[model samples]
Target: MNNDESQPENNKPKYKGKYRIDSTRLPAWSYASNAGYFITICTHGKKCFFGEVVQGEMQRSPIGVIAQKLWYEIPNNFSNCQLDSFCVMPNHIHGILVINQIREGDAMNIRIQEEDAMNRVSTSQRGDGQRGGVTGLFNPMLSKNSLSKIVRWYKGRCSFEINQIYEGFGWQQRFHDNIIRDEFALDQIRQYIINNPINWESDREHPPHPPL
Candidate 1:
């Protein structure tokens, strides 16, 4: 199996072309930098494996429970990362992630500021957004903390666990993301996620229902 936790040679995903979509990532931006990002990850073929929205509420399936749980666990795995607004819909998930690592350009100034911030804060007060010593910019494997790596770990882990009972569970080839530039944008995205379940019927990502 590959690092992405792909199935053994004997079993392969039913779908191909997961890598067909062109990347929407910014060329000059360093994904591991200090910033907030909005993320959307969809199940393969838009399957509603996560369960449905009922009376404007989300009812998670076994798989859905796993998805939501692991998302919360992200902060534990990546010290510099912290989750914000999050929701798991019938076929997809939406969340905001804040990376507190130093930005690439002007690394010196950023590192100094990061160090100052860390100094002013104590370990217990960091809450869910735990802050470690000023690091990440000097990480030997920079990509280790990059956004793509984080998402890959998340998707791969989810598939591995989900495939245990339901073999061949798959995710869309790539996820969609938007770098949140300001608090206004962040607030808007947060509300969108909060409202996802209530607005499921009209959501573009909503899967088609079978005829009654």
Candidate 2:
């Protein structure tokens, strides 16, 4: 019997070096694929800038209202995206964002933002003012319907609006996402979103100010 071959594969040493932060995303995964994604975005340093929890319920401050306003606007900005369950917490948020199928000729117009803010245009009105063929764009990075791109737009818009009133409002540099693999898992995540406010005190994403 060969001792080397007999050793379990788990005992092998692939690398004897310090590990660095690895991506949370699955390797070779195409986010553009039609699916449901559970996402969480935290405020900078998990600060309770949005609002507070009173009686086990989340109450969005004036600023928190802005955070939620932009969240619900995601579908308006990206034609093929739809929001499932979502809730705005004091310092963090939880939601299930679904990328849905787009039928043909449904697109009436498309809009994109460039490096120059002054050059930005908001309206993408088609003759019928409808959105169509979102997946046909092919290049997810550049497509209006891409998940990452949609998130970026939402963050940027919310920051822009909030900053106008409260300067330096920001979100964490990186957000977290979990890919939903089955209908059962999808329903579970959606329920979590709905119950986030009720579970605020016990939530890991909850802030430290209230000292829960």
Candidate 3:
């Protein structure tokens, strides 16, 4: 009668095979494109015990902490991308990510080359010629860089760190993603990601009730 027990005599697949794509196996174009996407990633085998709902609040599992930190830093790491909204629950994460194209010969490129030189100079002495200014590190326009690569890179690093913290901790082999084609859809997805934590108790993915 345990909640984690598999359904008796059922052959239903555990995940959406049609939508699941291994982030590690995706082609270059997938990461190079400037298109924005909303992605959902779940724990391996949908394990719910990674964390628990206490007093109507979802507490982060050790793995969840890694996920949250990595998700927040996505924007800083990928100058052309934005982490709009995200929620980390006990066994999964839902996030809205915007991928903007990075234009050639822009500030980002200029800053990249100047980083070493700037390091040698004091902050006050660097003045206007400093290589690693705010404008150099980030692009104001969101459409100039690749978002997919940012997510993949973040996930890869998080997995490595999580493995070090808790032996055998890792994400599933693949993740679920939906490309937002219009503003309306994007807004809806943003709201969904923001509200995910509040709706966790009623989620279909929550462990099923025991049979009589």
Candidate 4:
């Protein structure tokens, strides 16, 4: 029998589940304009291989190395974007990404600051404003680029290269994102990312089964 045929095919996911949306075709309404977004990405079904705390320090694992490489490469890949804060845990990652640009009608009098840029738009406005501007808030006019597409590209590229390095590891079909509305929320999320490693043991997504 072929080596491929000898192994069980059940390990592969049968359905994309919630993660298979074609990010490039994400409705225009989902675009994240000149704003700050807090993003979390997990390994394929939250496989935890990045690291386990040993002696109170995060020792590098294959997944951890891949996450770190991707974290540093964010700025290089996305122009007008800066990585404010981030953390790579064994099974997942949390990051603060600020997309810098002046929105129409935004104050051009003042030089664009990262914080000011992020706060320029409101998350409530980014929703699908239907009930009194609830869903319509995420109107297509506000977004400059397709947030979903960018994330898809980033994750896809990362997965391809990481798999090359490690041979078979993979990423989940999609990632999770939340727009930061105010300075307070931004700060809170930043703190969460910074402290993620400290709270790893209790993470809900920590994979229970390991590859045999």
Q: Against the hidden true structure, what lDDT does model 3 obtain?
A: 0.56
Model 1 residue 160 distance off true place after TM-score fit, in angstroms? 0.7
> In model 4, what is the error at residue 192, expressed in angstroms?
1.0
TM-score of each: 0.71, 0.69, 0.60, 0.63
Candidate 4 overall lDDT versus native: 0.55
lDDT of each: 0.68, 0.63, 0.56, 0.55
Task: Write the residue-wise lDDT of candidate 1 on 1-212 in tens digits.
Answer: 11321111222211111111112354334566688987878888888888888999999989999999999989878877888999998898888889886435545655564465445445424444433322223221244576767888789889999999788678987676777889987777777778778887777677676311
**Pick by lDDT: which candidate is best?**
1
Query: Which lDDT value does model 3 have at 74?
Result: 79
Tens digit of lDDT per residue, candidate 3, span 1-212? 11111112223212221222222222112333455677776767666524766665768777777788888887687776776777787777777777664657554654543463344445524356543233222211222344434555766887788888777666665565666679986777666665555666666556554211
lDDT of 2 by residue, 37-140 (tens): 77777788888878887886877888899989999999887878888888888887777888875755333223212222112222222223322222122223
Off by over 4 Å in 2: 1-24, 105-143, 210-212
Q: What ranking emerges by lDDT with the best candidate at the front?
A: 1, 2, 3, 4
